[model samples]
Target: MNEFRHVTVLLRETVSALRPRPGGHYLDGTAGGGGHTGLLLEKIQHTGRIEALDRDPDAIAALKKRFAGEPAVTVTQGNFFQAARLFPHPGFHGILLDLGVSSHQLDTPERGFSFHTSAPLDMRMEQDGPTARDLVNTLDEPSLRRILRDYAQEKYAPQIARAMVAQRSAAPIETTTQLADLIAAAVPAAYRREGHPARKTFMALRYACNGELDGLEEALLSLFNLLQPEGRLAVITFNSLEDAAMKRAARQLTAGCTCPPEFPVCVCGKSPRAHSLKPVFPSPEEIERNPRARSAKLRVLERR
Candidate 1:
């Protein structure tokens, strides 16, 4: 198995934001490589407990190996969106969800997460779903265009989708480089010069394959509900789509009564449940050390 080498983004910042203390029970909703969870374990010591979950089988194996024989740690294989059901006992002291692709997934060519590789177009986080090859080869142009536009916010989504369908009709687009080269050719040369032509397309496929943004806001709210009063739900997002959903969830939690100014008496019993702190970004030094961490943003919402 390839080494699960994932640099935990915003490590100190996220743990500090969560404020894990001895005897506090916390949750690492996405325990990829167990970086953040390992550090949090140190802070909490033997007194505290941590419930770690991940959809990736490799991640689950790594976490189990890393935390084995440690009674305080429990590693489970599942999606963070279903945290409430999976972790029936709520009232967690803190919950963290780091929504970024693991470095191992991208670096390992077989994962097909990066367009730079020449592997099969298979970017399944859980490793059991329709791959990028299946989507590009089978989906219609309009659906393909929608995935690109909605998931990655690709500006040339229509052109890319049209080209993808046209090329696949002749023969199935099979590999990472095949699709990457096709995208490079489809977009204008000027756009290609700006950056990788396939980056957005690849990201869109990963998102679609994993259902990353679907029911995302509701999931965020559910995770927040799992936290006890004053417990923090710290999430780290890599792109605008996820950040927007996180912001919306935080806004929903922080929103108070909806009664109008004209109403003299209190009507809506709804009050603020949580408040978000200032978003955290990677430091210049950290970014220089690991360029992949550049786009990460950490947002912490405290339950009231």
Candidate 2:
């Protein structure tokens, strides 16, 4: 197996924001490489317990090994969105979700998350389910176009989708390099010079293949509901789509009366369930050390 070395983005900021305490019950929903989990474990010492979950089998294995013989940590192989089913009770002191692709997923060529390397077009975090290859090879042009535009905000989505359809007509686009080359050929030369032409396209494909955005709002609501009073939910999103979704969810959670200005009292009787803190960003030093951290944004919300 490839060495799993994921530099946890906003490590200190996330832990400090959660304010873990002794005997506190916390959850690391995305236990990639166990970076944040390790920090949480340290802060809580041996008094608190953490339930760490990861969809990736490799990450689950790593976590199990890393926390072996440690009574304070419990590792599970599952998705964060399905966490409610795992733990029916609603009394978590804190929950941390470091969203988006992990460094290990991108760095490992076989995962097919990065356009920098040539590998089979398989971007499944769980290593099961439909893959990037299936989407690129089987999806119709319109569906592909929608995923590119909606997920990645790829401006030239139509052209890229057209190029994918045209290229795949003769042969299957089976590798990351193959799809990247096709995207480079489809876009204008000036656009190609801006960045890796395949970056956005690959991102879109990965999101679609993994159903990254499906039921996301519901999941966020579920997570918030599971939190005890004053319990915190800290999320680290790597893209604008996730950031915007989080903002909208936070607003909904913190929203008060919906009654009109003329109304003397709120007939709707909707009270704020949670409060949001200012979103946090990575430091310049962090960005310099890990360029991938440049786009990361951390948002924390506390249940009322």
Ten-residue region with minimum lDDT total, candidate 2? 212-221
lDDT tens string, model 1, 169-232? 8999999999999999999999998899899999999999999999999999999999899999
149 in model 2: Cα distance from truth in Å?
Answer: 0.5
> RMSD, each candidate, Å?
0.9, 0.9
For residue 202, model 2's alpha carbon misses the true position, in angstroms, by 0.4
The residue pairs in collision within model 2 are none
The residue-level lDDT of candidate 2 at 40 comes to 91
Model 1 misplaced regions, further than 4 Å: none
Report the lDDT tens digits of candidate 2 across residue range 31-124: 9899999999999986778999999999998898889999999999999889899888659999999998888898899999988989999999
Superposition TM-score, candidate 1 onto the true structure: 0.98
